[model samples]
Target: MNIKFVCFSLIVMLFHGSIIAQELITPEKAVSLALDNNYGIKLAKTDVEIAKNNADILNSGYLPTLTGNAGANYNLDDTEVGFADGTNRVLNGAESSRYNASVDLNYTIFDGLGRSYNYKQFKETKQLTELEARETIENTIVQLFTIYYKVAELVENKDAVSQTLNISKERLLRSQYQFEYGQSNKLASLNAEVDINNDSISLMNTTQELNNAKRDLNFVLGNTIPEDFNISTEVDFNNLYDKNELLNKVKDNNISVLQINKSIDINTLGVKSESSAYLPTVGLTGSYGWNKSNNNAASFAAYSVNTGLSAGLSFSWDLFDGGSTITNVRNAKINLESQNILKEQLLVSVVRDFNNAWDDYQNKLSVYRLQEHNIKTAQNNFDRTQEQFKLGQVNSIEFRQAQLNLLSAELSRNQAKYLAKLAEFQLLQLSGEILNVEY
Candidate 1:
């Protein structure tokens, strides 16, 4: 049973391994794939299409409506008739039939420019859809870049841990050899072995972290998570901008702010549309028809056919509707004002975010620089200590401390690098330029 289970597991592993051959993707490709498949972006695109459909002038109630009508009826009955001459006539199995057909047309000639305002409103609304979709795509792009860097960070830490583990393993082997040669005490050999085990555990944890980061990246890309993959290790840290310059860009390009600006225009049009209700509406109506009737009644049988054409102009003035039109216009004005207020708020928010992101990136970059320097110093110190340990000048305790310091510096440097990268992406997102990011 054990052998069978082992074989089954091996087969399963092979299948998954074959299917999940490392999917290498650059950050640019990740963003492109996400923009194409992300559910929110897809829905936003559909909203834009719907707005475009609604913007068609033909859908703005500008065209005439035409309809065709036709009908026929037949009946049979006994009938009795009394004429004014005081004579009565009776007929059996009386038959009658009627046939009619008509074509009708109605056209609205005027509506106080309401249709024009509505058309303009739809156009603005369509632009709003585009801006909203841009916002979604930008958000996803920011996430892609940040998470890609995060994976790089975790992988860096994992490599550092593995390196530390290898150092510990070498120290353990040296300790064992020294103890066998009676150069190091047995206690030193046991301590070295314990450190090796601890470093191995740390390596395992860092590997798990890297895997989680990759999974998160896959989620953002709207793709299946693979067992393993490699991302570019290079992170750009030189994309710096002055706060004033960034604010200028944000004002012109922020998607949320642009959407609010467009909303104000749409709401202004809404007021105009409502105000148009106070004026009169004019329409043209026309119809042509043919009708025929036939009857059979022993002495009063009759047959007739009639045809006619009719056309007329119709007008309606909604002089009053209990003040609803005025109320609607006032409400629209208030909403328009609200949109302007929101736009101001968004501008302030975007500026604040941009500055904070820029500052955070700079701060993390500083930390990264410090950690980088610290790692160099620690590496030098560890190398000197290792040589001393080999020559019996430094104890194993001092060498272990040096190794720990180097590992800590390495991990902190990796963390700072990724954090700075995240801040950079956030700045781009606020500027509405994340989607333009390349590798």
Candidate 2:
């Protein structure tokens, strides 16, 4: 059964042509697809990876560094003389070379509390990068949600126009049949054709609009025009769910809010990192070396041996190095405070955004419901007028008006339905439930 479904899906995916396509897409699935495939999301992920690598580099400072050295030298002069028992012997007038090798180890003995604080700063910076990436994704999700709904809206409008065009064609056919039997005037036949032509032009214009909307949606999804892909008209706008619970969810769920909170954490750490700059730091370091020289004769008699090795502890003090420490500390504190203020601002903004979205959603819902009611009334009126026209109690003009009323109601209802759905999706997006949607 699963295999059959997969095969069926593939067939539908490839079956884009003259007929209308209707593929089901939920907000969550749309977002997931975009995050995986969208150019901006991929770039944001790259940013995250870059931050992780930087963190690794900063953490490596805690490890010891080993350095090796080797050198060879030629003293063109016979520069060596030696005495073994009692007498001094003259060395060569010829040249001799000395060679030496050693390895040095540095492990940060002590400093005026610079490395520790600097390390803390590195950690905070890395964390800040991560938060920035999350923030980017949140913004991208908003854009994606907007474009997705717009495409859905355009598609629904196109369907509505097509339905109206079909009705116009039926009217034209009936008028022609009547004219042939001498039951209707030639003018009625001409008027019916005019209606059909007008509807045809309107449908064409709507198709162009639908294409433009699709192109824009594809651009943001990092996709080209997909062959044969269409959206389902199954969304239920009549579900009058509450906005209060969703608003509550935004406090902890919204990615932007969480990202800002993460920034606050980074800033808090930044203050600590900077204040530690005033304290002293300590560690250990050492090095070893061996040296030798050889004397060869022209007028020489000398030899050289090992010089021996030495090692010691090292310390650094910033007794006064430009007063940057105080300035940096002050700067860090200010930044920390700024981040806190930013958090408060974002919190307020989230609430306002939700309220605005809720108001718009409710209005759209009302319009959709009213359109639904209008559709029934329009259909009933059209039926009565059609019966009157058949009995010759009303002319074609009155019958056409009643039919147009029904068409207008349907078109208006489609617009209202999709607009309401868009508002609902936006509300969910603000609440961060797009990620949690299961089906």
Candidate 3:
């Protein structure tokens, strides 16, 4: 008849039921599993590793390249030769062979600091990848919490419905006994039966919703099969967050803003790298080569050999390439400017979202508290109505009304509690602090 008694009874029933034997998944474990198993997180981490590898000096055009070459060729054919003195000779099966080998090295000595800027850009790209990975991790954790809370909410609703069903069963039994003794009319007994059926349907629907919520939670955790488990129906959140502090943290740590800032740095480096193309490029080139030839036809010597080492300095300046270099430089500068604008836009959007989430959190928390108070009032009213109904001072309709009122209040309170908790998570997420939550 009252919320407190119903809760106690529901707990006793659950203790004897299968729920006591089910696995209890805590928030911490859920997040840990998701981090290990989620596909998005795995790919993000891979991208981060690739970016780190790309940041190496070998990829930055700073190291010299060495190459080796070797070749051999042979020919057999009839040959004829004529001298300037009017003498002619002919021979069959003339044989000739040639062999060559070389090793070359090329190095860029100077490129107007383009290599340095490119290397810095690589490092910045690596940082951007790391930040993107962090964002993925944060988003996954937020999603995990959302589903976790949803399961908890549905579980609470299921418990509430179970309690209501039990009360309806008891009322039906009492009504039957009173009717047999002629202390209650047949219509009252019939109404109680109908109420029992309605409660049964509500219980069934609540159970179905709880099952679906659990399945969804399993998917979020990357579970291929649904796990039979129970969740703690407790929604906890920080009630003392300072708005100004959160806003500052958003500016400092929000993933989108950080990503955009990193982009701006990379684009600035791009501008420098492209501008370097305007200056002359100085390079060093060296090679050691060997060649040998053999001929059996003997118009001259039978064999000749040549071997040498060569080195040279090379310089080139792109005075004009149909304005391509200038265009590239201009485009790089434009990209840099665009990134700066994007950062500004992203900051504005981040601030607006944070403000909205903050307000939503506060509003939902107030609503939850109001529902808490309302449930207490509903409980007191139900208790009085239950006592009056026993003494026949209240009709069956009035008693049922009180019962429904208490059930409705309990459901509303559960919903409000989880909604407020979700809003709190959103706030923390905006501040980039959701990853720091302790289960």
* 1-439 per-residue lDDT for model 2 (tens digits): 9999999988876775334454455666666677778787788788778767766754737677889999988876744555567766565566777889888887865554445555665666677676676666667776775677667777776777787778778777888888899998899889888888888898898888777776776777678336446665566654555678888988887777877777777677667766666666665666688787876674344766675556666555556658898898899889888888988999899999989988998898889999989999999998898888878899878987887788788778877887887777678778887555542
Ranking by TM-score: 3, 1, 2
For residue 392, model 3's alpha carbon misses the true position, in angstroms, by: 1.7
Q: Could you tell me how far off, in angstroms, the CA of residue 158 lies in candidate 3 after the best superposition?
A: 0.1
Off by over 4 Å in 1: 1-21, 224-226, 296-301
lDDT of 1 by residue, 143-262 (tens): 677778888888788888899989988888888888899987899989998998899888888888888888888777676445577777777766657777777878888788788888
Regions of model 2 farther than 4 Å from truth: 1-29, 57-60, 75-93, 109-128, 237-244, 295-310
Model 1 residue 106 CA deviation (Å) reads 1.8
Clashing pairs in 1: none
Off by over 4 Å in 3: 1-21, 224-226
lDDT of 3 at 217: 82
For each of the candidates, the C-alpha root-mean-square deviation to the true structure, in angstroms, is 5.3, 6.0, 5.1
Per-residue lDDT of model 3, residues 90-160, tens digit only:
98898999999999999999998999999999999999999999999988888887888888877888888
